[model samples]
Target: MTRTLVVVGHGMTGHRLAERLRALDTSGAWRIVVLAEEAHPAYDRIRLSSYLTGGSRQDLALAGRDFTEDPRVDLRLGCAVVSGDRAERTVRTADGEQLPYDALVLATGSEPFVPPVPGRDLANCFVYRTFDDLDAIRGAARRGRPCVVVGGGLLGLEAAHALRLLGMRPHVVESASHLMPTQLDAGAARVLHRSATGLGLRLHCGTAVASIEAGPDGAVRAVVLGDATVLESDLVVFAAGIRPRDELAAALGLERGERGGVLVDENCRTADEHIWAVGECAAVQGRCYGLVAPGYGMAETVAGRLAGRSPRPFDGTDTSTSLKLLGVHVATFGIIHPRGGPAAEAVFAEGTTRYAKVFLEPESGRLLGGILAGETGSRTALGPFVGHRPPADLEQLLLP
Candidate 1:
C-alpha cells in the first residue's frame, strides 16, 4: 500500500515539511497533500508588517504562486480542517470533505490575539497578521489618518513603523514598562524606547486600554485607559499577542498545553501514533517556541524520522533573540531573569549600555545562561552559549 501524508496548514512550517520530506525521502512511494485555508498559497507571514506599507500581496509569498505537475502533490486551498478523528485517520473540513491519510501533520499556526476591549469591532480596528490584514490596514491608511497600535513587541513596533510608512504617526501602547520586554534586557529596552521615540512614534508604557470608546455612529474615536485617561484615535490595530489554533487538536482528543497549544513530544509527535504536530501550535517540554528557527528544526527532525533516519530529540530552545526596533538594533539571550543571586557571577558589563550577566552553578562555573545587550558582537556568540556547546571566552568574543 502506498503511504500518504496529509499536512493540515499551508503556513511556513507545513510548506517546509512538505519540501523536506520530499527531499529527504527520495523513495517514490509517499504522496503529499497540503491544505490551505485561504485561497492564496502560503505567504511569508513574517513580512506582514512590510505588506502594511506599500507592497504588493505577492511580496509576502511563502511558496510559489502555483503548485502543479511532477509527483502530483495535492493542494486543497480555501478549505479549512474543522476537526479530525485520529482513530479513523481522517480530518473533516469546513466544506464537509474528509481527507484520509496514513500520517498527519498539524502545522495549524497561531493567529493574532485580539484583546477584549470594547469597540474592537469598529471598522477602524484591526489585527496585523496576514496579507489580507495588511491590505485592510493599507486601505484604511489611504484616508491619511493616524492609527494606534496596542503593543510594543517586535511585530507591533514593526506594524507601527509600517504605519509611519503609511504616512501616519502611530501611537504604541505597551502594558509592560519596557518595549520588547521578552527579547531585550532592560538596557536594550531603554535603547529601543529611545529609538522609537526618536522616530516620532508615541510610546505609552505601563498603561493599558480599559476600553475603546467610539462615536455615536459606532466608529472608533478614542481609547480609554485604565487610569481614566482617554486618547483620541481614528484607528487601532491590536498586536497584543497570539494564541495557538488548537481547537481542532482538542476536538480530536489530542493533548495540549494550558494555553491551548498542541502537546507534542520532543520529536514533535503527539500522544496518538502516526500523528505529528509542529510550529507555534506545538508546546514541547512545557514551552511554546514562537520563533521560526526552532519550528524549522522541528519540521526537519520529524521529516528525518519519517524517512527512517535517526533524528535528534528536541530540548526546549534558548529564548535568545535580536532584532531591529524601528531601525535600532537590540539583542538579548540566556538567563536574563534573576535566578541564583550572588552565586551567579557577573560576566560582562560595559558602560551601562553593553552588559552580560551569567548564572553559573557557583561550583562548576559552567555557563548556565546570560543576557547580552548594546553589543552587536554578542549576536554570533549567543548560538554556542545557549546551546551549551562549549565554553568559549565570551569576554574575548566581546573585546576588539
Candidate 2:
C-alpha cells in the first residue's frame, strides 16, 4: 500500500524534497501532494532582483516540466493549508478540502520582517520578498527619484541594485556600523562600501529610520532618521531580515523555537513521529538556517529517511555564501568572526578595491573561516580547504 506524503509549502526546499523523495522511493511507496500558497510553482527567489532588470518569471523557475508532469505528484498551486488536525492526521485547505496523509512535512520557508516604524504601512512602502512584492515595487518606482531601502544586508543591497537598474537613486540605511554586518567583517565591508559608492549608491550606516513621512497624497514622501536627518524619497523598501513562517505550528500545538520556527530534531522530525519539517520553517536542533544550501541538505535528509534509508543526522550545514552585489563579488565561508580570544588571521588587500582574510586555528594551520570581497576568484578553490589545513602557499589563494 502506498502512503500519502503531504507537503505544505512549495518553495525551493519543498520542491527539493519532492524531487528527492520521488527519486529515492522508486518502489512507489509514497505519493506526494504539494500545497503551495503562491499561484506559481517554485521559482528562484534569490535571483528575484533580476526581474526588475529584464529577467522574466520563466527565467527564475526552479521546477522543470518533468517534475510537474510526474504522475505520482499532485502539485496544487494557490492552495494554502489553513489549519490541520494532528490527531486526525489530516489538514484542511483554504477551499475546505481535507488532505489525509501518512506523513506530513512543513517547508513553509520564511516571511520578510518589516520594522514597526510609523507610516510603514503607507501606500509606497514595500517589503522585498516575493515576485508580487517586486512587481509592486517596480510599479511604484519613479525614474530619477530617490528611493530609500531599510537594512544593509544581502537582500537590502539587492533591492537597492534593482532600484538603480530602474534608473532610481537608491540610499541604503543600515543601523549597523557597516554593510552585511552578519556576513562580512569590517575590512571586507569597507571594500564593499567602496564598490557600492562607485556605483552611485548612497550609504547611511549606523543609523535607523525614525519614521516615514507621507506626502500630500498619503504616500511616502521622506524618511526621518534616528539622528533627526530626513531623506527625501519617492518610495521605501524594507528588507531588514526574515523570520520563519511557523504560523501553522501554533494551531497544531507543535513546539517552536524561541526565535520562531517549528522545533525539530536532527532528522528534521517533530515531536510527533508522523510530522517532519525542513527549510526556513524548521529549527533543526534549535537553530534556523536561512540559507538555501542548508535547507536543501535538510530536505535531502528527510527524503532519505522517509525512503527507508539510514541518513546521517543533520547537526549543522555549510553556512558559506557567494554572490555578486552591484557587480562586486563577495564570498564568506565557515566562521567569519573569531569567538572568545582572538584567532590567528591572514589578511590581504589591494588598496580599497579588494580585500581577503582567513582565520586559522592558533596552533594548527587548519582553516576556520574566510572572507573575500571585490574579485572573489578563489572561492571555488578555497571552499574545500575550510575546516582543513590549506595549502602551504596561502598567499596565492588570497590573490585577486
Clashes of each: 1, 0
Residues 1-400, candidate 2, lDDT per residue (tens digit)?
9999999999999999999999999899999999999999999888899987789999999889898999999999999998999999999999999999999999999998888999999989999988898899999988999999999999999999889989999999999999999888888999889989999999999999999999999999999999899999999999999999999899789999988999999999999999999999999988998888889889999999999999887756457888888778899887765666677998888877889999888988789888999875568788788889888777777873
List the global CA lDDT of all models. 0.76, 0.91
Candidate 2 has an lDDT of: 0.91
Candidate 1, run of 10 with poorest lDDT: 63-72
TM-score of 1: 0.90
How many backbone clashes can be found in candidate 2? 0
Error of 1 at 111 (Å): 1.6
**TM-score, cand. 2:** 0.96
Q: What tens-digit string does per-residue lDDT give for candidate 1 at 1-400?
A: 5688998888888888887887777776678889888787787777777666666777777666344344547887888999888889999999888989899999988888888887789878989877777777777774456678999888889889888877887888889888877666565576567667888899888888889888877878888877787788888999888888777777899888876788888998988878988888888754677777678888998888887788888655455556655666565555444344644555565554455556555665655666555554656665556535335666766433
TM-score of each: 0.90, 0.96
Q: Which 10 consecutive positions of candidate 2 have the poorest summed lDDT?
A: 334-343
